[model samples]
Target: MGLAAKMDAPRIDRGLDDIYVKETSICLVDGDRGRLVYRGFDIRDLAQHSNFEETVFILVHGRLPTREEYDMLRKGLAESRAITPDLVRLLRRMPPDAPPMDVLRTAVSYMSNFDPERDDPTRTANMRKAQRLVAKFPTIVAAHHRIREGKRPLAPNPRLGIAEDFLRMVTGKRPDPLSARIMDVALILHADHSMNASAFAAIVAASTLADLYSAIVAAIATLKGPLHGGANEAALRTMLLVGKPENAERYVLDTLANRGKIFGFGHRVYRTYDPRALILREYARQLSEKRGQEDLFRIAEILQEVTVRELKAKQIYPNVDFYSGLVYHLLGLPMDLFTPIFAVSRVSGWTAHVIEYWDDNRLVRPLDYYVGPRDAVYVPLDQRS
Candidate 1:
């Protein structure tokens, strides 16, 4: 082996900037161009033209479906909504202070315990589990939250889209139509990215031929980092610190001066606007009008402006995290719960990717460039003492 080939150290948690595996389909992101696509369809077009259910179908099955197939997929999602009564019992029993993501993790773990085919290694069985998880995730998360909050869980409202249904479950009231549509697009935008950290973790775990649940567990751990799924929660907290629109620019500058990486500005992927940021920006606008929180909207606008100017000065650009937290705020979600809600959307992608890996499983072994000191001869145990 060449000197370069002899190196063998782990790829520690430094930022990875290259693709190391083949994926059949993905949400294509041109980070420099600020574009997003699912399979071959652009994110902007999909957000405008599609719903979460259809998008899930596209992600899983690798194409947009005909009307009948879409209907079938929708029905499957609907039918898969119920968590086991025992699952509900378990959720209610979890301590109130338990993190929602932890609750969600337990819920997915419980699913494998209850379902017979959950451990099956075959693609058919794994796909069925994937469909169930994709279907039930929002239901489980929302229901678990409500139950913990001492409210009765709302059964899935079939009349609403998945986003609306989730909101209905969460708030114990129907979301306003415009608000629901905005959130639908938000969920669509968050659904998947190509080989993101969590997705890669899921693929790596499954490449070991572990059961899907085990793989998903590893993925969730990766996502729990503040730099990843936690970004939205951080973004919202940052806006709250600014207190109002007029102060946004000053606050951003102060943060920059403090050498703080303003959460939501940088991304490993997008070099320009995060496509999701644009979708959520529309949501923020709509909510501003409906709720008459124009000041909050203004704050968000200023923040966006500041993000661009500051990041440009620093040679960075806004990523999806930049504007999404404000939309969640305008939608009246609890600030801290933002990342948990992200897990609710991202579970679909994680499971889908895991199943994909299982279909053509291989241990994800990679060569590394090690530069540590060479192996030294061990001293005799007694002599050293």
Candidate 2:
């Protein structure tokens, strides 16, 4: 081979950006058109027409549920909503200053100890475990937030749906119907998105035949990374810092000039405006108006326009995080709990991927191109000089 050909022969995909590592039937991320799909259904439809419980059922079971099936799933979620009393005491004892994501990771790990099916990888058992996780994660998060705020965690109200129950638990008051609807859509939007980092992490753990809780713990740890799942928190902070619509342009220009990342404006996958962001942009407006925070929403709008104008040619556009934080803020969620709430939604996707991984499982071991010297002689310590 020519030298040029030799040099090109082993070009490994750095970061595996375009590499298709495995096949999945759970979700499809249409990066080109910025659409997200769950089991052949458009996320926009699911977000508009379905609730979190239904969307999660579709993701895990690979189809929409019949009314009986839907009712069963909802009943399971409702019945399993209470965390163990031991978990509650543990939550109370945890460091109040700990990062919510870290606390969530540890909590999931601890929860596995109480699971009767902790070691069972059977499909039925895994599904049952998934039901418990979906039910308890919001409770865990709200409880943690409550403890840190010097309030006792409230028991979940089984009469309400997950969104309303979580809101009530965290804020000590039931969310209005519209706010609950917004929260439901947010959960559906975040439920799944192909094999994002956290799902990939869960799959890797499952590829090793680890238990479901361990796999999800892996996913939670991965999602704790700022680059992967913390973008919404950072994005909201940016808008908060910018403070007003008129100041957005200067803030973006200065940040870009300094090579600082403007979080929420770009994605590794989507080349077009993110469909979730499109839906949330409107919610942010309406909810902000309701909360008398029109100025805050306007700042986001200005930033969106400025960034889109400057970066659209590069195919860098908003990807879900841009408006989500604003909505969360209007809902009275604390800033630190933002990513944990992401976990609350994404656990459905992570467990779904893990369950699917075992169907035709293989270890996810990839080779790296080594660059260091291959041959070297070791010198005795006495002869080193």
Candidate 3:
């Protein structure tokens, strides 16, 4: 009787099959098939040959920009590097303990207030917004860190590439060329992965006719939760807390015994491996070699090996987070700043998503099942008494 009654109720949870927006993109990922393509070209091809600005142009305009056009975009980026003084003052006023994601979420939303073209979503406007978002997000990130440390924010250097300029602004020194190149490739690799959590959130919000900033703010908020963008920070923290490679197996066992989910091992979408993870594993390894820090490298490698064996036995696999924290570590980012750095590059993809949604949007309203009493009424309290 109980089984029959349970079977009578409708399934309330949807796997949400419609969330992935299939576009005629050159960007493609066949996870189970272990394939990744971008702009009718493979990622490996792009990583070998293309830079971040080139990749960003590809994602935005659906074709590589010509040299003259690329130069114009670069100047537009540099010319727009500095944030308003008003924004700086507000950032300085924020509490030192505020999370960087929160700072970015709030600051980006606040950016709309100053823009005369904020309401325009025509192709021209979106193109401009895309450029502004990609250029300014790093500034916002660096300001949050510097103001909290009671240090002045450094200006973005026009001469530097995106990764080097970002590192220079945040760390107040230029990075080694190899380290910067690795970081740039990581950013390019991470720039898009169709309809992931944050992208979906932004699209759903945009479907409701929200402004670009509103859509982006909601997406950043979604990314702040542990199940999504926060996992990399969790990954870094897990490594730090474990403190040694020999302790990792015991730590995993204890964590599993406590029924705690390991941060970097499992993913929702991928079956065999995350393509981005493979890309970043190289960067992490390269950086460790360059810095002659074999211990850090060995610790990461052991953790990766142990995680792959245990998790595969449990039918799980390493996701982007697993390798990304190691890359960020090698690139000399503070643990706390890992996810904000993710935002710096992902803003390009997010802008692309919002633009796509605005072109052909419907309100993202879905039906819900009502489980309340069919016909219930309230009685006057005094009368009932």
Best by TM-score: 2
Off by over 4 Å in 2: 1-9, 373-385
312-366, model 1: which lDDT tens digit per residue? 8555766777777888888888765677777777777787787777667779987
The digit string of per-residue lDDT tens for model 2 on 1-385 reads: 4565568667788767778867889999888988889999999999879999999899999999999999999998999999888998888888879998998899999999988899987999999999999999999999999999999899998989998899899999999998999998999999988888898889888998989999999999999988888889999999999997899999888887898878898887789999999999999999999999999998998888888887777888988998888899999998888899999999999999888889889999988765555568999999998
Clashes of each: 2, 0, 1
- In the range 122-211, model 3's lDDT, one tens digit per residue, is 878878877988888888898778889888998778877787888877877888888788878877887877777788888888887877
User: lDDT (CA) for every model shown?
Assistant: 0.80, 0.90, 0.79
User: Could you tell me which 10 consecutive residues in candidate 1 have the lowest summed lDDT?
Assistant: 5-14
Q: Give the candidates in order of TM-score, highest first.
A: 2, 3, 1
The per-prediction CA RMSD against the true structure, in angstroms, equals 3.2, 2.3, 2.6
What RMSD value applies to candidate 1? 3.2
Give the TM-score comparing model 2 with the true structure, all chains together.
0.95
Off by over 4 Å in 3: 1-11, 15-26, 253-260, 313-315, 381-385
Best lDDT among the predictions, by candidate number: 2
RMSD of 3: 2.6
Which residue pairs of candidate 3 clash?
26-39
Clashing pairs in 1: 7-370, 8-370
